[model samples]
Target: MSVRAQLFAASLSALSLLTATGALAQQGGLDPAKLGLNANENLRALAGSSNTAMVFDNRYEGIKGTPYAIPRWLPAKLALTSNIPVASVLLKYDVYKQRLLIRDPSRPDSLLLDANKVTGFALTDPSAPDVATGQPRVRQFRRFAEAPVATQKAEFVEVLYEGKYSLLRRYAKEMEKADYKGAYSTDQRFDELTDKSIYYLRSPEGAVAPVKLNLKALQAAAPSLAPALKAEGSKRPLKTAEDAASLLRAAEGQ
Candidate 1:
């Protein structure tokens, strides 16, 4: 095969794998207990009794609006609590509204899972590319809710790095509006959807505290490892969450 043909074949193979994974997740044949759930707990009971599904309306008035985040339907395992059975379903995270949307097997429409009820969740997608390495990435997100602290509210934060001192990423979204003037008239409308990735540090004492994505913030969070982190940052540019994770791992001597 030619070089272009080889590349196209590889792309097709990757797409096929992703499609199969999504189909399996949506069809719901996977055992919940095997997915890290308590075997004795009732799976159907934990899924709740609600039949109403939340629909995402992308049309504002008559105009089509863009989604706040890339719409990804992935296989996910959700835990309500240790006592309740973990539910395995196809879920989508709405970064715009900070909501977990689920397509229940019994429901025709997508339903919003209660954020407060969710203890944690894991999403797996095989189609994404790794940020650090330019290879095909099986993206996995493991997030858990922490108790509200004085500085931050209780919300699901993704575990970026876990050690004596851990790094977490929190996602928040806000709507921006502006006045759009047409040829005939003007009207106020949503200009864009803005999202923020806020990083936090979990101390060895198990307290969670917010930290900015900067070397100074990392140093402040771990005063003992300040000099080491600064050295690491000097070696390589610390510009993203992945860079921060690399720094943390180095500082911890992992």
Candidate 2:
């Protein structure tokens, strides 16, 4: 056979191997090592295994409603700190499940990083508009390893006001029955999205405690700033997370 024909046959065989093993299906076209995941060597190994459950799949087409934190998907940077070198990667966060997802160009399937493996992350999206003042809402989050609130598992908590006394917000999402039924069937089986938020206070004494959403409870939590909080509450009651954050800032003399 001619040399050119032999070369062509070898190329075809290599392509067939890649296709059968699914090696050419990676997304994002980046290596996990570049994403600061040396410690997760096991996870990378599992990606190549025949067992499919190890791979993270984001295509949920069932009755599950939207699973994103924001109405729109915003580009953000994720930071992870571990025995491996600290690395930052462009990723997305699903606020509903509180999971970090990434789409690697090298793989056709996306991967979900274990929350426990992440130290913290930040969103680069422009500040959201506040519901009350129509101003941009600026918030940052950190992994609260020892959160005293009902969210027993340590996760990201928004830092509302940071000072001698700090206020934080924990967001949660759940699914509920939709008010309207599916158009195709009479069975009222459709599901709707619902969210829940809880606020907490971290005092100088190192106590992280949950604060109720009422004026009375706010006052009880911070007796020293009761008067100031009450004054702010009179102007704008603590009916929303932004309101609570604003009140905390006022108490801090910001």
Q: Tell me, by lDDT, which candidate is best.
A: 1
lDDT of 1 by residue, 1-254 (tens): 89999877866865665566556666987664443343222344344477778897453544234442336677787767554876588887676566788886777899888876776676665676566676654333444345355333545667778888988877666656655556654565546656665778988887777888889999999887898898888887788887888889888888
Of the candidates shown, which would achieve the greatest TM-score relative to the real structure?
Answer: 1
Instruction: Give the residue spans of candidate 1 off by over 4 A.
Output: 1-70, 82-87, 95-98, 104-108, 127-154, 181-189
Model 2 regions lying over 4 Å from their true place:
1-64, 83-90, 103-110, 127-138, 149-151, 177-187, 235-237
Clashing pairs in 1: none
Q: How does residue 180 of candidate 1 score in lDDT?
A: 53
Error of 2 at 5 (Å): 54
The C-alpha local distance difference test score for the whole of candidate 2 amounts to: 0.66
Mark the 10 consecutive residues where model 2 has the least summed lDDT. 34-43
Residue 171, candidate 1: Cα error in Å is: 0.9
